[model samples]
Target chain A: MTLYFMTFILFCIGMYALVVKKNLVKKIIGLVIIENAVNLFLILVGFRFDAEAPILEEGMGKMVAFVDPLPQAMILTSIVIGLGVVALLVAIAIRIYEKYGTFDISQIRELRG
Target chain B: MIELHIILFFMILAALIAVEMRGLLNSVIALGAVGMGLVLQFLLLRAPDLAIVQLVVEILILILLIRATVKLDRPSESTLKENWAYVLCLLLFAGVFLWFGYRALEGLPLFGAPEMNVSDYYISNAMEQTGAANIVTSILLDFRAYDTLGEVTVLFTSIVGAIAVLRKIGRKQ
Candidate 1:
């Protein structure tokens, strides 16, 4: 319960940064924070107390309990997807910097065309 | 349990610093700290696979962000009063949003007591069917191979898009 509450707070902080910050890099940072918080929430859902990792070991009984593997598998894909997103976002930010000569959103508000 | 709480608290503190810090490079480093704390939490949660992937991905992200920040000669600055107003509005919105989220979260299974009906089947039969020791690997590579394929496609597309955006010129003109 407490863990979920803390995760929620983490997510809210990210939202605050994303909405309130004017710098493009800061906004990217907020996106990263939000993604990580959601991933943590997924893992928290799959977690079980006193469970072993989901690996089959020789001589281990079939009934031995293991932490859920479904979310872990899904999160593996998600982590890679996050990398791709961050890379593209950073590239776009750099392009914006090149054209406008600034990373501040306020200064870059005008459209050239 | 206590350690988990400590790390979560530390992560939140680092995120605040990352968002509020004046120096761009410092803020990026603080974000890296949050990633490291997340890696630690993954380890503590019995997910070594996630911990490893997160560590590697985090290193790449930090490097990219640091490079981007270091290349800029001037610092970013914004007006203080406007930022404060935004923060106050955000706080009011967050308070309401969090109350609703709390109610939604109440219906979920408690921490460390997840219902694993589906995964139980995977754990018991995955080894014999897939001949793989790691259930996660088998599920990802065997049962969910199509999803993995889609994920790879997404990565490839994004990388190509990034390259396209970073080119010296977008058009022949």
Candidate 2:
């Protein structure tokens, strides 16, 4: 579907930012974008037209059409992982700024071989 | 469907602006807008649980980024040739991945027709097995509880790592 292709395009945009940006914070932002794009893609894969949320009601007999919930659960874990990774990245960025006194990757070349 | 497409378009635009913007703070804000667009898309796609999680996580990330970058000066720009190299590398990477991804997509079951026997079993028996009305919750807490446990461990480890890293910086100052 067009929608799924569009999500891939978004993923590519994130990849572009990640590779092309020089600022450390911008790189982290790009990483976050890539994480979100994957989550969106997974959720989109699980969606069904006209299907309700996968919540069963009391005495609602024979639920016919509920969207898949497995991908939703997996994505929940992924979103949480993204949060942790971002937090760690920001902390590291702060430390890198403290040591190097700059946020530009080009200028912080101590680690370059 | 058209509405969903419109939102996806806006999301892509926001992503572009976020990537291309000059100011770091403005780019972060744009990224937040992209997150909001994703939240809306999740809601529209019948994933309320993901929508809620995304909303809270996005706000928290925005706060963290703002706090980290608040006192820093403007980032210096890289050289033009380096930028071109970066762009070319990404284009090549994207082209390869896109081709593989499209091929993979064709092999996948069509949209709205999930063919997983595991999911079917969960859908049919989750209520009786877990007594949870929400299938997502049941799957998360009851069926695949070990995965949740592992996820919690990962979160705990990251928190510890962050605190340790930040604490070192404080002591050095």
Candidate 3:
């Protein structure tokens, strides 16, 4: 229970860093932290105490030993998506840095509307 | 377990606020954070399929963000309170939504009987009807193919928009 709340706090902290901090790398890192926190939370959601892999074979009938496999499968997809988003964001970050010569974010100026 | 989701929700809201601040990088990070929290929420709701779809979209968004940032200079911070009234109005709208959400969540009925679930209808026959082991795939590609087609069309349109916007940059690079 406490762990769950702590994870949430970690997420909030990451957001704070991403929001209030001016460093580009730190902002990216904060984004990573946020993504990781969510991934952790998802894992925790499907977690069952002392549970085994979800695969069911012969002689496992009526056995309550398996945790859910659905979340893991979903997590796999999410991880892939996270990779893509991270890559795109990083690429954009690099471009912004080149154009503005600074990562302070407040210094970059072209996007309106 | 429930507490976990509530905390993630708070985290998401905070991240949203953070992104709305004066830094472009911070806003991008906040966007990612919101995505993360949304993934967690999907997991809690037992909808892994939606989580995966959203996750994939986030990756593309990150790429687009990075591309734009690299191509253009960052916007200068405007300290002037230009949108205070709009922000206040948005806050009032959010309050209404929050109250509505609270009421909806509180009124959810308990489900103890599997026989009462409409999903059971699909659970038993989805594979047979759609020839897909993944229920989400079956529903997406079979039962809801029209909507899926629409989504694909939207994707194609976005790709066109990207090309149109980046054509000049492509020539330079």
Residues A1-113 of candidate 3 have per-residue lDDT tens digits of 44454555556556655555555655665676676666665556555545444433345444444344444554554455555455545655565566567666544543321
Q: Give lDDT tens digits, candidate 1, residues B84-152.
A: 888889999999988998999899999899998888888878987999998999989998899999999
What docking grade does candidate 2 earn? Answer: medium
For model 2, how does the per-residue alpha-carbon lDDT over B1-173 read when each residue is reduced to its tens digit? 78889999999999999988887888899999999999999889988888899999999999999998777855454222246876788899999998888888998778777666688899999988999999999999999999999999999999999999888454745
Compared with the real two-chain complex, what DockQ does model 1 have? 0.80
Query: Which parts of model 3 are misplaced by more than 4 Å?
Result: A1-113, B78-80, B104-118, B165-173
Q: List each candidate's DockQ score.
A: 0.80, 0.76, 0.09
Q: Is candidate 2 or candidate 3 better by lDDT?
A: 2
The TM-score of candidate 2 is: 0.94
Q: Kindly indicate the candidate among 1 and 2 with the higher TM-score.
A: 1
> Where does candidate 2 stray beyond 4 Å?
A110-113, B75-82, B168-173
CAPRI-wise, candidate 1 is medium
Local accuracy of candidate 3 as per-residue lDDT tens digits, B43-75 = 554556656666666666655555545444346
Which candidate's lDDT is highest? 1
**DockQ of model 2 vs. true complex:** 0.76
- lDDT by residue (A1-113, candidate 2, tens digit) is 78788889999998887888878888998999889889888888888878888888877877578888999998899899899999999999998888888888877885543
State the iRMSD of every prediction, in order shown. Answer: 1.0, 1.4, 8.3
